[model samples]
Target: MANNKSAKKRILTNERNRLQNRFYKSSVRTLTKMFLNSLEIYKTTRTPENKEKVQNTLNSAYSLIDKATKKNVFHKNTAARKKSKLAAQFKTA
Candidate 1:
C-alpha cells in the first residue's frame, strides 16, 4: 500500500502507463502477425494484389513499431530488430 498522497498518485500513474504500454505491445504483435500472414499469402499466391497487401501490412506494422518506440513502449534497438526481421522475411519471399 502507498503510504502518502504522492505515492498513491504514482501508483495510479504507473498503472495507467502499464495499460498503455500493454496496449501498444499487443497491437504491435497483432500487426506483426497480420504482416506475416499476408506475406505467407503472397508467397503462396505470387499475385501482385497479394504483394501489395503484404506491403501494406508491413508498412502498418513498421509504423506501429516506430510509434511504440517513440512512445518509449519499445526500445529503439528492439524496434529496429523487429523491423529488420520483417524486412528480411519479405526479401526472402
Candidate 2:
C-alpha cells in the first residue's frame, strides 16, 4: 500500500506502464507467430503469394520491434537480434 501521495501516483503510473508493456509484448509475439506461419506456408507452397505475405509480415514485425525498442519496451540489442533472426528465416526459406 502506498501511504504517501507521490507513492500512490507512482503506483498508478507503474500500472499504466505495465499495461502498455504487456500490450507491446503480446503484439510482438503475435506478429512473430504470424510471420513464422507464413514462412511455413511459403516453404510448402513456394508460391509468389506466400512470398509476398511473408515479406509483408516480416516488414510489420520488424517495424513493431524497432518501435518497441525506441519506446524502451524492448532493448536495442534484443530488437536487433530479433530482426536478424527474422531476416535469416526469410533467407533460409
Residue 75 lDDT in candidate 2: 92
Candidate 2 least-lDDT 10 residues: 62-71
Best by lDDT: 2
CA deviation > 4 Å runs, candidate 2: none
| Whole-model alpha-carbon lDDT for candidate 2 | 0.95
| 1-93 per-residue lDDT for model 1 (tens digits) | 999999999999999999999999999999989988888889889999999999999999999999999999999999999999999999999
TM-score to native of every candidate shown: 0.96, 0.96
Score each candidate by Cα lDDT.
0.94, 0.95
Q: What shift in Å separates residue 11 of candidate 1 from its native position after superposition?
A: 0.7
Each model's backbone clash number: 0, 0
lDDT of 2 by residue, 1-93 (tens): 989999999999999999989988899999999999999999999989999999999999999998889889999999999999999999999
